[model samples]
Target: MFVKISHLYAENFPQLTAPFRPIWGPKASILLVDDKLAAQLNLSPDEILAALQSDDVAEKTVAMLYAGHQFGQFNPRMGDGRAALLGEVSGQNGMMFDLHLKGSGATPYARGGDGKAGLGPVLREFLMARAMAALDVPTTGSLAVIETGEQIWRDVPQPGPVPGAILVRSAASHLRVGHVQYIATMGDDALLSRFIEYVLNRHNMRADAHENMALSLLQNVMERQAALIAKWMSIGFVHGVMNTDNMTLSGETIDYGPCAFLDEYNPASVFSSIDRRGRYAYGQQPAIGGWNLARLAEAMLSIIDDNVETAIEKAQSVLSGYTALYDAAWRDLFAQKIGLFEVHKDDGDLIKELLTLLAKHRVDFTQFFAELGPIFLGEKKRDADNFAAGHFGMDLAVWYEWKNAWQSRRDLESMDEIRILDVMRRANPLRIARNHHVEAAINAYIYKGDDGPFKALYAALSNPFEQREEWDIFDAPPQMNSPPFQSFCGT
Candidate 1:
């Protein structure tokens, strides 16, 4: 079996990459393979493993270079510490996707840490990324997970040296906002110009080179980020670490470390243990998204306009547009979630009230919306009773009051009940990567040497929009535990 791997990015941008080789274990083995994604990449699991172990491919492997602001502080030197770009694979659609190997080995940017990933984090990303893909969110897809047959140290439950593994990540491109920031700080306008052109051509984004090339690039990036973030928020996802480097130019969700979905409807939720001050809190994601984009605007100020003042003005104007862009996307998505097929200006208040009630009553975020469509269609009497018993607890009056108002709002829509329910079922997911369930699945794989739990959850999440009685367990929230849920970077 032959695989056509090309070094397009490394060959085109030599200055942005360092030639490298992946250090593999003595007994590396494939653990999980996404068959659909494998087909898209035009390769089998065996061919992927063969390519990763091939000396000919290792000679062309490279670790990308960039700079980023990690948690509000600028780090001038950062890159793929434990990952290697094997190169690009052209999908069946003729579009090129980068096939990068994570947990491969140390690069020049290792910064004094082992270039290895634990089995737990490897499985977490595999499940999380696939769930996001099934939900139709723009995210980096996982092709396979390879158990490296080595033990690596990590600070997780049942912590000791844990089994090491590698993930094959596929994406539209590996370019990040930090990549642009890297060239912007090199004190070479020609180099930055070339980098910008490379991104534009790679992603096929149109920008007039003669007039304000960087400004045009900024607009394109803002549009993509707006839609991406909107989808994430609608699904209650927190990227945990929204550093400039993690904000990909392609707008796909990359780097799922410390990431978790919402359980209750609390806006102040913070899962990443390192997020001490709540900078990337659930409610703050939208604002933080704009802040990250501001950093990109700062990096592109040079080529945005010849005049510094004009550049600043143009960037600010575009930055101001983020609020409207995000708001529109958010509103449309939320409206559909509640069966508002024809959105009205007052729908904002209705949506706000529902969130307020959920937060106030401590209701399960995913479950509530999942049941709303059926409940609205005069079905799921048991779901209504369960809702009251689980949260409201003998006080159905408040719940019914809000439901009455929402139903009144829906009455205004011209679409019939069936069509309205169709809109809602599509908008609201039947399942999410809930925090406790994810932990249990990880524990099953790491502790019990059992992949059963992980496989069951992955299969349930694959059809996230459909209702299956047996998968009801997947939709349930975690029981009350001693400590609050805290996710790790798993570095």
Candidate 2:
């Protein structure tokens, strides 16, 4: 069923585009359209194509304002910059998701840069968001990418490869806490109160009765974010930026720019070139989440409780939920990664032990976890011939050393070993967004307009944990010629 979105508040902000169609703006080129999403808007692919080709209002934009911290410095003027809210619709499972456009144009918060996106960043977000959805992550979905048929100057001059990037994206809501904070900094307490009320009414009415509604909302987002972050780590995913404005109050992975997964075990590794200080590093994500939530709390201080102090105390209490929630969520996810069904408290120790082993061996997180099936069955073998059946002897010594503790504790004879093997098979992914693979896709598209490599990558990553039939190249990491990958912040 299609859910209709009404008009945006017109009196407060000036419409930048033609009055006849506020959603229509300076988009240059229109390319691939996702037909599945196009159909949901009661639109056909051809209609969407025509909409892009003409100056039609393809999206119902709801432009929002927000403020946030940039690299630990308070930027009271930050908002969507180049992005605009396209509006919301109810989709699969009664979830109402917002479909917005990025790289549309400069807004109240353009911050002196042309509100444009590079092709690399655009394609990266597209592939990453799709891969994440397949991995069962709550994320913004990519609907389309339009090349403006223009070249944008970045680290140097290059074609945005399209005009500039035009992406139609889907999200739960665009009412970020940073938006509330931005209004607060305007010194209009009434505006802040309205903002708080607007957010509470939209996403967290359950917390409305509480004196500290914003704090209550923060708690909700924290619990969801903790689980989401843990799920990312369990699957070797890295979100290069954990900035406050980028974090949605609705608890979804909002931005996918400059994100990649680990191909080798380096806890401190950062793939985003702009993340030189590792502000959003692998281990620092939880801390960054806490810090970002604190900003959200600070934004709500004006109207959160009856007075200020009580609200501060309430936010402090809620912020404490971060560590406990993250810990529990992480342990549970890692337990699944380790292929354990009935988790005892000792399972935590068991997990840590394996991670320590991985660190020592410098094993690639994805390939190592995925090797569990072959390794476990090798351990249960009655004779050397049985181990050879699965080529489990390729790295026989390291494999045996790893499963030695499992043999000491679990009952391989009493338990169905095949069941355990099956668990391992599903727990670990057969494919992931390896850096080289993404590069291959980009290069293939830019050079030969070849879709074969990307199609194969998508097929593999779509069913990450499943054993696909054409699994030769996808099963293993790229060879030495394509060793490490480094993605940069498109800024």
Candidate 3:
């Protein structure tokens, strides 16, 4: 029983409305579905499938209107061109979740583009979103993927049209900062107020005073975003397109377009083909995150206070706190990565030094941290030596010096070695959704119509922290001489 949740967004802002159009040649064959999430939502696989396949579902769906700042430029109108909010489901935990369908069909905001998705991008989002969840990063979860049995043209380096698919993406809420910004730009104070109240109630956030509701919401979103971005940085995840529209107010990592995990520890790594200027690089994520939050703050100004000067000051104060919140989160996570139970003044410096060394030597980001667990636990000296030699090559002397300094700090902490090693094991994942492996899987599925690689990669990434013999190959980085890998927005 899918309950329509009052259609609060559409009811509040009728001007920003569009109806969902049915998928062309809709053949809903399930490619991937999350049984775990299904159970959480109290829906069986068959029931979920039945509901999705129902003809009425398309008619009931709504495509939302919004705007975004793309590549530091504001586009005043960009909405769900190819996606639709099917309906909302109340989870077992009493939390409200939205089931949005990507590649559903055409919407009013299609803007001359086909309202469809390629199989590769759908599979990529499913894999990457689940992998992020396993790594304890807050992210939207894929409920199911249904192959549409249609071909969609894409601008991939390859020549032909690719197979189309629809991804059932579940999120705490699909509302974005851009949505609020859109309402604010309309100059409709009543609609903006209703939207803010809807968000606060939906997210279960409370405000002490009516006058402070917007400021309170802004504070909550900022704190969650700070912690969320820190989690992404700790795991080497680059949200390649950090546009305001892509930044979900629910604090979960949303869109997977052009997103990738770092292989070699270069802060300036750019995977998104469209990011020619490297605006959303790995290291720049925090700064970009702050910039997005500033946009949110700007949108909330009128709601925060009636006086323009007062509202700007209030927003500025909150925006200024983002740096401290981000820095503290980064420090704590980096500390955990290095197996430090307690923070020391020099811990930040030590962490920076290690990252500097990794960057200089071009070490694999996942492997470097994963290998450290065994070395710190004294399980494999030979492997540790080989890893050191492999990473440092002729520069073993400096590597050894850094290793010695790190060990000295560990020793000085007097923390139980077993406890420290346990933290390290949990902090360092043995496998990530590696770009090369993901590409190989996509290639297998797209060209050969084989899903073996896709399934295997999903299984390996499902439990990335575990050391499993079957997944050992997934841990290795791609060959150094392999062709440079690039990702696209899959639009």
Candidate 4:
């Protein structure tokens, strides 16, 4: 069945119809779609196969162009350097989304490096994105990844370094806060206006950005980012790098490089090798998200209003919503995790205490809480081996305290215990995109071309809420002294 990938194009993004080739910029591989998402989106299996092989697809993707500040330095020329928007398609629950191919190669924005990606980064994005979706966070999904059948050299030679990587990716839309920042810095106010309008009409356009609109767009964006960062925190997921370019205005989690879950809960935990100062660490994410929104606010100032002072005032006022949105979102999510339905005015304290306990115990964030489900955080038999044998760090005492509060709070045993268990299990995720597990699978598949582990990981993550005892390892954080693993700069 020669399914032409080009047929998937929905008569948009005319650039897609251009005479394309076997994408020759180092990484050149084909994508293939599995059956599950295909049926749900009404996307034919043939269309998925077509999208994978044919370089030419008739698409009218308005290949957006913009620049951004990278690492606090206004590069002023940052856009989709190594990515391309294939088009948008329906996924999960009938949501129309972006179908981009990462590692597709350099565009007008590729500023002189090998704009290629490796299999490691490709697999990392897939696992992290899928895990995020299961975690109930809005994120891009990993559609497919294939070996490009070519070599790409960065620093040191790694597995499949001889062969480059190819990835088929999915997202709500690749537009970012940095996307707006790019147009504004270019002083292309006309395009900026279009971009704003595009965002408003496509996504929920905030009244804030309008020229005469009442509610400020900056404020609405602030509220969105605030809520977003809170959701990230509730799950103990550190974005590692929260660069403006990586921050999508669509409020979807985009880049998944160097990102990690908090195995040992620490407010200052930073796993991303590039994040030396903990700038985008676990606790700092919420604040940094607000800070990034401020940059976005500056970019939208002109569009907000002609008068600079008035626009600045309006933007600042909107920024105030960051905390409240963050608080409300965090409280709500954390409360649900703990089986608390209604959030008391003081429920924030209870949530903080649980995190404090996790930090003190050095408990694997996913596993510790998930382990609570079998007993539902009830008493478990563990004298001191797991905790004291290694420096689990007084987690036993912390767990004891957490249990006392949790037990007292369980005011609904009369209610369906199964329902509560289901909620917690779904929230806990029987599987997470664990650091070592993903790394091991990527190494095996990319380096060895063995798809067994990678397929297994995808399978386990697909049913994160479903309790499958066989895939429990996918949920637990890997212990140290196993192997020294570090991520490369997927440039």
Candidate 5:
């Protein structure tokens, strides 16, 4: 059965998008299907393939247009260069998600390069996005991956041709901060207002009696982004790239290129090979998030208020609140990880001290917290040996000292032992899509045409909080003295 795809964005804002058809390679085949998401949408792989092959959906496909600040420098013209928004579908949850096709070939924004995606990157996004979703992080979702029966030539990460592929991605809406920036920068005031209204309506963020619509929208976006970044920090996920275009107004994580989870607890960890300056390091995420929101605030300043001075003041007020929102969320999340259910004002100090200890000892970020549940419940010993293997040259006494301090704090709050263990288990993941594992899975599939390892890894990542003997291998981090992990943009 053919599932109808709504032309919501295209029919309403035709000027903001260019109609296009996907240029699929010969012998295109479905490489993977998100069966869970497919069932939610009442769709099947055959139906999805049929729709793409049919002219109806292809005719409705469009390449979005918007400009953005790439790495602090403004790129006046940029959009879906290698991708097309096929249309929209309503899920059982009654939310409209855009079905976007990546690596579908070039459009006007392709600039001069070929609008194709390497299979490695397509699979990378497929795994990363799904892993994030299961981890309870708000993100764009992958629907399917289709092999294009073609080759993509690239030099970085390796010097050879790789197989080409397309990923069908689903998101709440592809309306990015850059979308509003485009209209405002072009002096199209009327279009900007229309677009803003469209977004407000889509997200059910109508202005209340106390606030103007544009100002309310800015505040709403700021709040979402603050919460989103805190979630990313809670798990040790580094987005690698934080460009304005990649910052969705929907506040979901997008553009998974070079993204990775931390192995060691260093705040300064950076895995993106292109991030030599560490602009988007693990610790810098919160600040960069605020920086990106500031860009959006600047773009919407005109509609925020009639008077320029008044608009700046109003936008500044909303921007000022981002730090506090992020701080509170970060503190609360970290508190949960350490079994401090009732967050105290001074809890920040405790969190900071433990992180400092982990960093000083080069401890595995995920393992230290994950092992806490069993150790606290008496299922595993609470001695220094439990954490000794993950770090080196550490005073065993310091471990006991930190544990005593943590226990004292929990006792001060009158926290129950079993309840604290439950909270810690929920807050900390037993397994994560570690960098070495992800790289190994990608290498296996790309070189040997093997999906067994990739499938197994995804299955383990899907149930990160659960204890499974079969997935115990994923709990291990990459070994010390191994080469530092690096990821490429796969552009």
Candidate 6:
């Protein structure tokens, strides 16, 4: 194995070091290993298993120290409690990727809690990460899910204990805004400078043209995050936790805790069990994204320039660009979703009105877009009609009006119906990892030891855009009277 242990953060800031303790159990059955990533790394299943079981590898693992603003309050110290960075591996493309293990026992940052993960959350992240990738979303990739053959206590309604598991997550880098914030809070200018340089090199960010390296890095992160949040909004994905620690500087969606796709199109939908005030709700994500980036800007201000006042001014100036960038990306994405080849000023209003209608009728967001595929194709009126009735009930007058207006706008582009339908199909997915379905799969697996439901969901979500009759069951949302669904952080 051509493995390289960078440990850049640890080497620079020895104060953040934490030893990795091996997790002992009777079994470590590999649930899902990403073969594509394995091939890229020239690793076989046996090799991965060997690496997981090796105590030497565990000895080399390091837990990082960081701090973040959780629910708008700053925590001076927060770090990997149950996770540790094993090492880095250079892929065939020469890009370095971090192999991080979650549920790998306790570290110094465990904070009086057992450093363990439940099987349900591990499987959820594995499925959710793959599903997001299929939808063309940038996110951390799950390399594997290994059952630990142990049980952990959680707040789920179920009795006894939940099965434990470990998630092998791969990412470009585990660097987050909070990591910089931690260094900044420590008042270590030298450490911050080294950290900034490390990040620039890791992400291949050029700072020569910019007046300051900190400013350059901040701009790069801002633009990437703006576009990322836009993509999330377009697909109705609510990242339940938007803490500073959860925001990756690499622009990929990092944590999967309490994250979920929207079923009913409510602007105020919040799935994270801890977010009682809806600070990270669906409609609030973009703003929260900007806020998180601002925190990053604050952390880098000292390094942005020696003059504190000038640095503040420059950082705010860069921060001001976030809204405009986010708006443009959001508009462009919604335009594509609505089958608009070219965007006009009125297109925003049209999209907003449609969203208002969706929220008013409590329609399933994914189904609404997916049903539009057939409507644009002009192939299945009966299916479309059923969807309308199911979604809009007895009154669909507003829906018809919106449809007429949308068709008129689409027609003005003079594109073939086939081309428009193709665009719609690509923009909309027929299958999503719905909360209810995820819960059902978890229940089945934990209660009955049956992987049938989980496997079926995995297969359907793997090809989200494809239309297949067998996947119809995965298309629908949970019943209206079904027990209210809530997602947990599983920490």
lDDT of each: 0.87, 0.68, 0.85, 0.67, 0.86, 0.85
Instruction: Enumerate residue pairs that collide in model 2.
Output: 147-162, 147-163, 148-162, 148-163, 148-164, 149-162, 149-163, 150-163, 151-159
Better of 5 and 6 by lDDT: 5
Give residue 320's error in model 2 in angstroms. 1.4
The candidate scoring highest on lDDT is 1
TM-score each candidate. 0.96, 0.85, 0.96, 0.85, 0.97, 0.95
Q: After superposition, how far is residue 142 of candidate 2 from its true place, in Å?
A: 0.2
| Candidate 5 weakest lDDT stretch, 10 residues | 384-393
lDDT, candidate 3, 192-262, per-residue tens: 87788888888877654334778877888888899999999999999999999999887999999899999
Q: Whose lDDT is higher: candidate 1's or candidate 4's?
A: 1
How many clashes show up per model?
A: 0, 9, 0, 22, 0, 0
TM-score of 1: 0.96
Show the colliding residue pairs in model 6.
none
Off by over 4 Å in 1: 208-211, 381-390, 393-398
Write model 6 residue lDDT over 1-491, tens digit each, in one string: 63444555556556665767558456878878877667766567666867756666677778888999999999989999899887777777988888888887877899987888888889999889889988899888888889888888876545458888999888888889989999899898888888888888888877663688888888889888999999999999999999999999889999898999999999899988889999999999999999999899999888888899999999999889999999999988888887887867798899998999999998889988888868656687567777777889987898889888987888788678788778888998988999988888877987898999998888899899987898889888987877666888887
Q: Which candidate do you rate higher for lDDT, 3 or 4?
A: 3
- Model 4: per-residue Cα lDDT over 1-491, one tens digit each: 43223223324323222322225444444444445545655566555635544435423332345566566777766666676666666555755666666676666556775567876677777677777877778776677666676667666324334456766666666778877777677686776766666666556656556344323456556666777787888777888888888888678887888788777678988877777777887899888888898888888788677899998888777787777888898888877777677556657887788777667766667666566555543344353345333444544565666567766766644445567766676666555677778878877986688978888887897777776777876776676545533554566
Error of 6 at 109 (Å): 0.3
lDDT of 5 by residue, 218-239 (tens): 8778888999999999999999
| lDDT for position 225 in model 5 | 91
Indicate which candidate wins on TM-score.
5
Ten-residue region with minimum lDDT total, candidate 2: 15-24
TM-score of candidate 4 relative to the true fold: 0.85
State residue 2's C-alpha deviation in candidate 2, in Å: 11
User: Model 4 lDDT vs. the true structure?
Assistant: 0.67
Model 3 lowest lDDT segment of ten: 2-11
**Residues 1-491 of candidate 1: C-alpha lDDT, one tens digit per residue:** 66788999899889999988888777888899998899988987767798767787889999999999999999988999998899988899998999898898788889998888888888999999999999999999998999888888876654689988999899999899999889888877888888888888788887873256787778888889999999998999999999999999988999999999998889999999899999999999889889989999999888887899998998998889898999989999899988986768888888888888889877888888878888657466556667666776666787788888887988898999988888889898989999889999889888998989999999998889877898889998887653689999888
